[model samples]
Target: MKKHTYILASLLLVSGIALAQKENIKRANKLFKMKAYTQAAKTYETKERTQEVLQNLADSYYYNTSLQKAIETYRELFVKYGDSIDIEYHFRFAQALKGVKNYKEADEHLSKYYNKPVNTLEFIEANNKITPHNFKLKEIVNEGSSSDFGLSFYGENKVVFASTRNTENPSYAWNELPYLDLYTATLTNSNTLINVQPFPEAINTSLHESNAVFTKDGKTMYFNRTNSTRKKTDEARIAHIKIYKAELINGEWTNVTALPFTSNSYSTEHPALSKDEKTLYFASDMPGTFGSFDIYKVAINDDGTYGEPENLGETINTKHREQFPFISEFNVLYFSSIGHQGYGGLDVFRSNMVNGGFDKPVNLGNIINSNLDDFAYVIKEKDNVGYVSSNRTGYDRIFSFSREENPLTKYLVEGVVQDKNSKKLLPGALVEIINQSNKTIKDTVVGENGYYVFKLEPNKLYKIRGTRQAYIEQELEFLTGNYGKSHNIDINLESLVSVEERIHQNEKGELHVQLDKIYFNYNTSEITNEAAKTLDVLVDLMKKYPSMKVEIAAHTDARGSEQYNLNLSKQRAALVLEYLVNQGINKNRLKSVGYGETRPLNKCIKEGICDDEEYDINRRCEFTILK
Candidate 1:
């Protein structure tokens, strides 16, 4: 009876532990569905390392920008359940790897996930050369403040931004930072902020307020404010954000009210206005959004009413986060997105309004972006200066940048391929640019006009080669030290057949230098004075076309033993090749071969078959172009 009671107790304990684990997993899933990634991750960490728990835990870290944790968790998921995992996990793992600058590892996963090659370093190098502007970023410092961002131009000499400096406010669960509040400061001529003060109680409630925009006259303002009351949505209690409009009356901001389109169920934030204050742009996760958040614009009519909000469409929004929309004075839309192909995290992108629709967005590149969240970009086109927010330094901080056009964008090399004698364009000719390392950087065929253009980088040495099937290839060496300058160089190719009448094709269709007998003394391979003159012509041709690669082949008449003739011809070919190398030609560009009596011009097979003159015809040197 005692043994049976002990067995029953053990079974009951196991059942209780299993039931508790199931309840914990259910609670964790509920939190994850509610977008409470911080709490969900903690809860999931206490559960078993099942596939579902591991995937959610990894994703929770990824969503919160905790890349190191995400990478570790993702590694575990892949190790345990790689075959059953979705392809999307590979993408996420690659992104996390990129965030830590593990480009080689990231590329391996990216290539597998996309079924195409992806090289982050190459993309970064190319993007650096093509991106329009370079930035000089300086962090805006606020004493005693731990986190601050989302700066906007308030007036002629003032700025407004959001900060989590107030310690008395409640801590946010996502990042453990205090709730945000709107603060204004004086912008000095030296780009420093001073006289920092929070807005009045009407604008600064005991809730989150941020991303404020103002009109040109400074009388109207729009900003984001979190709801003071909690509500249930999608089975989760949350405080949704909304946009608020305020009017300046009697030198004080009053009459603050929520925008009509805002609701307790969804979020509408990051307000921006057009230059004329006729259109208001903001980011929202409301119903009908393509993803977590998308940029939306609404028309502000003259009667103080708003038209229906219009989504920016699929061209600008993806099935992921797209937020912090800012419309420049030139009508270009700038926003932040995690869905686009970028270095990592949230990268800022710009899209121009073309024919009343936004075109494909272009990434802002590495200078203005980082491997962490970078959002809230605002710029003045005329001044060529801007302010952006980033969490790269472990906390959100404001940075001011003075933009300058990238020198590589304006540095170009363009040329035309032409015939040396005719002075006419040589269409379909190949042009190649090689670096100092003998690596080809770019290659293209000349168009109908025989013109080719290539963007070049500064402070580099390069060689440009032009070639055609029947023409001698030409090479030109140039340097790109003077940036923002265009170079026009014309390549002229000389035809081999036109240059010499003796340059004829043999029966084997090989072009050879059929010179007067290259007299080698009776049985010796020594070159005579007459033979030297004939070889000089070949040397001059190579000098004129530096890119020419040639092979010197020597052959003997069928007048001696096969082994003896072969040895003699090989010595003769080596002698000629040595002469060319002594005359300043690159050794790598020339090769020597001896065909001996094996490749005779006529059918002279035996020792006595051919006469002396006919045998002399077979004993000669030939130059065949190799490239």
Candidate 2:
């Protein structure tokens, strides 16, 4: 009886421990939902490795940029629940792998998730060639602040930035840092922040505020403000953010109010103003969003009213997060996106405004973008300076950069296309830059001035080709010098007038290539040995000018019925064309036509109207150059 009582006691102890573990898991989940990633990660570490627990743990580490731990946890989760895991987990796992520069393994998962091959290295290399500018970055020196970002210019001398430097503000649940507040400061020439002071109670609130933009006159401002309460959505409860505008009146900010387009159900943040201050750009996740967050724009009218918000569309949005939009003075859109194929996390991208709409976005390349979150890019285009925010060093830090034209892009070839003999500019000519591998890097048609330019890379072998209709193609092979060096390579295309002279015009005034008489056997369309030799000359000419097109015409005597003569001539012309194709001429460049007895060199229009010599003159083949 004592042994039985001991067993019951052991069972109760096991049950009590299991209940305690369950309670711990519940607490961890609540923290995770609250976005207290750091605290949740520690709590989850002590829980059982169920799929749900492991997924949350890995994501917690990933969100906090603790990539190594995230990678390790993700590996275990995939190995244990490979088929059951959601595809989105693969993307996060790949991002974690890439954060540590493990691109090879990360690409495997990305390829599976995207259903296509993704080579981050290739992307970087390609972007380097076209990214117009290279950046020289210097991290801004912040005093007594561990996190600060979203630096924007204010009134030419002062700068406005968001920071978590206020120790008295309530701690944020996301990172356990103080809630963000807007601060104004003087950015020193040596990249130091000085005279830093928070905005008055009008702009800086107890809740999170960030991403401020100011008007040129410094009379109007727009910034982000997180909601005081969380609203439940399809996935979880989220604290939606809104854009607020404040007017600087009588040396104090007043009339602070949320934009009408903002709502409690969705977020609208990161406001940017156009050069004319006529349009406002921001990031939002409201209805009709293509992804988690997309860049949106609304026009600011003359009376301060806003037009209907417009999404930037698929060209600038994706099925992932795109935020922190900054429109430069030149109307170029610079935004951060994780949806577009990037190094790993949010990378800065630029989209030019062409024809009054944003074009395709291009990654800013590796110098400014890291394999971690880099966002909040603001730039002054004319000044060639900018500021960007990044979390590459485990904390959000602001960086100021000076931009210069890329040296590789500076190494260019420019010249004019001219007529070789006439010394005249050959407008509408095609100028192509081909690499050593015979791949065309760039091509352009010269305008009225016959001038063209192509950007080049250093230490590369390239050939410049100039081509025009009825002209002999001119190609010059050259090697590129070092960066900042350029070449003037004028392409002088020679006209094919000499070749055209050999082409005689028929009595009908149609141009036809004059070759030696081709003789086929009597009553048969078979190509004779003598005919083959004559056709070889035409083959050689087409080969010399690859762009040349030819049409072979065969005419027969009018002795037979016209239909019979037409059929026989077509067979003869087809045979000659077949021979030319066999000799390596592109079939597309060759055409065959049977004039039959309809066209005659002499007045032999009907049977017995002329002698054998007149009939023989009509029964000959003529080659025509189509192009």
Candidate 3:
């Protein structure tokens, strides 16, 4: 009897396995017909369909930025296909992982395709350390509804947003769709959310009023309106979306008009004005996109009419969703993206608009991201904190964060480079500054008049450098620690072909000499002929003070081979001693010693650091009050 029971149990197990397989096959076929591969991918566990299903599933989840599922399916397919599989899939998979912000895993997979990873841990680590922000919860600008989004403060104590909270029953809803109406709320210093009222006929019209931003004077309002239906509406008759601008007349909006070219068989919303209030930026799904939603710009005519809309291009608009752009008066831009890696969901990013074009958007980072959607970000200049609507509490609500002045304060080092002999400004010279690792930290082009400035973060070492086509490079290094103050430096960047010095008497009657300028070529030991002229000056100084003995100290910025630099310094000192001897100064009066970048007067540390401009004290020759 026991044997019979065991046989029956085995039969049942086998039947269950067969049934599961059949069920999976049926479900897979059905889902394929329904184009639900993303939902059915796991069920279709067949070698034949694995690749196709994975591809389909990836596409399906991608539209929603659901990178976790997409990555899992792609990984399986990649493993099954082995080493011969196309790397494109891996690339896409890595990109999706980056969207969900699994940067480490994304990098691990992405690194396989290239010797150098573009968004490596090295890049991430470096960027994360100084990425701006000190954040806090400012206040709930909008609440009590699921659609309170895109909050823009238009007037004192007044904020506008879109909401779908049910309104009074109408003689049938406008356009047969759940209405998105424009609502306003008053803000108290205590951050209390109250006095929420819907904007009347001026801005809201039973259509969707999702986004609202204003001109600098708060005189005009630009907001989105879409008479959207639950399902696809009539192809030709579908009411299109546009950015409508209305003038604020006597505390009320009037003369609503649609901004042009932004409407062409697609939705255009999320309008933000430039700092000068001269242009408008928004997002659209029209043609010519790197991805789903690309940010676009439209210049405002001097008469207040809009010029043709232009895409923000690849800098801010990635191949992933780039929406809800916020422009500040300082030409700083803030936007939301899933393309850039963050802690999770959609994250806010920032970048400066340089030379009238937007720079690459930088991810705001972990301090602001959550597992839920974080979008519709805005930063008011007077407020210095970031505000955005989030669903962290299971409902879309306003959140805020702040850091030090303007999030992060970058330090500036200002100086000028000049010829010690002529005192003439050196224009168009190149500069190279090194850090602790003996690597170039800073490089700059000296402007006409020898003026140059470098920007850097505090608490880091720096090597400030300047150079020109014919002249040798000048290197200096310094330390900028955790202080709010800045450094003003000057470099009498003499030609590499020569050296200049100023001499004085010390307490012991030995010569105290200040070398104003000495220049060298990049990563080399060759002394240019002009350098001899400077050495002659040093020889003359020694001759004038024959009783004084001096040490020829050669220094380098925090860059290049430490040992090599030391040797180079020794060579330089020997050259100086030889020049002095040739000039009839006794050899005993000059002690040749190669400091080899040691005993740096400037506190520069690290490699390849582009920082502080005051670090020009590293390379020089000085005489102690020694006999």
Q: Which candidate's lDDT is highest? A: 2
Per-residue lDDT of model 2, residues 1-627, tens digit only: 999999999999999999999988888888888788999999999888999999999999999899999999999999999999999999999999989989999999999999999998898787787677989999999988999999999997899999999999999877899999999999999999999999999898899999889889999999999998889744357788999999999999999999999999888999999999999999999989986999999999999899999999999999899999999887899999998988889999998775578877878888789999999999889899989999998899999999988865557789999988888998989999886557786899999999998777566678999988657888889988866688899998876764456666557645567788986655679888888998888888898888888888999988889999999999999999899999999999989999888998788899977887777878889887666
What's the distance in Å from true for residue 136, model 3?
A: 2.4
TM-score of each model, paired residue for residue: 0.64, 0.68, 0.53
Better of 2 and 3 by TM-score: 2
TM-score of 1: 0.64
In model 1, the clashing pairs are none
Candidate No. with top TM-score: 2
Residue 7 of candidate 3: its Cα lDDT?
100
Report the lDDT tens digits of candidate 3 across residue range 1-627.
999999999999999988987777666655544445445554554624555566655655553355666677777777776566676666677766766667788787767755466564565555565565546655464555654567787666687777667555131222222467777787666676579888877677756677888776888888887644432333213455777888989877899887767564777878998877788889887789787788888888898677878988888887778888888766688888766655445778888655567666666655565644678888776667656887556455776556553224456678888776777887866666665556665677776877777666566677776654323345667888543457877776554234423655446544455654666555555666777677777676556544546777666666767888788778777876776688798887778778866776655753465353433456555544344
True lDDT of residue 424, candidate 2: 92
Task: Report every candidate's CA lDDT.
Answer: 0.86, 0.89, 0.67
Clashing pairs in 2: none
Residue 262, candidate 1: Cα error in Å is 2.1
Name the 10 consecutive residues with the lowest summed lDDT in model 1: 508-517
